[model samples]
Target: MNLESPKITLEKSATEAFNFLSDVQNFKKLMPENISKFEVLGEDKFLFALKGMPEIILKKKEVTPYSKIVLGAAGGKLDFSLIGNISEIETNQSTVQLTFEGDFNPMMSMMIKGPIGKFIETLVTNMKTAI
Candidate 1:
């Protein structure tokens, strides 16, 4: 399954936003309220549980200074990647977008697409407000 989040114009510089997102712990503020647990294991890794979903651990897979951050989960029932893209709009403003890609069986993809898409959308929307 592949899903792209809406682009958001943020009231912060690209570097500022990048700094906020570089730390995985800050992600808790962007999660759905239904998230039941969150744990920060390292600067680049964290584990989280959603109300009706199994706990998942994600770690930074790659990053480029002030421009992009990619996160992925290692061996698991769900193989997925979440990417964040940032661009400077002005000295004090930036544009941000998020995309989520998941590798799942056809049946599971069809079953989870809607909910997962909405979840990513919510996360992107919250990023705009959270910044």
Candidate 2:
């Protein structure tokens, strides 16, 4: 399954946005207010849990400087990746969009489609201020 977030413009430059997101510690600022738990495991990994979902561990899988960042599930029942794409729009502004890709059976996808979609939307909406 693949889900993409609506593109959002940020007040910061692409480099600034990328730098902020590169650090695991700064991710908390982007999470929803309902985030039940969030913990940085290391420089490249973190663990997080939402109110009604199981804990998920994600690690930085790849980075393309100021262009993109890819995070994948460390080890869990699900195999998925969250990708952040950044593009400079002006001297001190940029646009960001997030994509979520997951390998799940049809049944599982059907079950999670709604919540996961909302989750992505929330993350994107929060980016307007969080970034």
Q: Pick by TM-score: which candidate is best?
A: 2
Per-model C-alpha RMSD: 1.1, 0.9
lDDT tens digits, residue span 48-110, model 1? 888988888989999999999999995577889999999999999999988898889999999
lDDT of 2 by residue, 1-131 (tens): 99998898999999998998899888788887789999999999999998988999989999999989999999988999999999999989999899999989999999998888888788878878777
Worst 10 contiguous positions by lDDT, candidate 2: 122-131
The lDDT values for all models are 0.90, 0.91
TM-score of 2: 0.96
Best by lDDT, which number?
Answer: 2
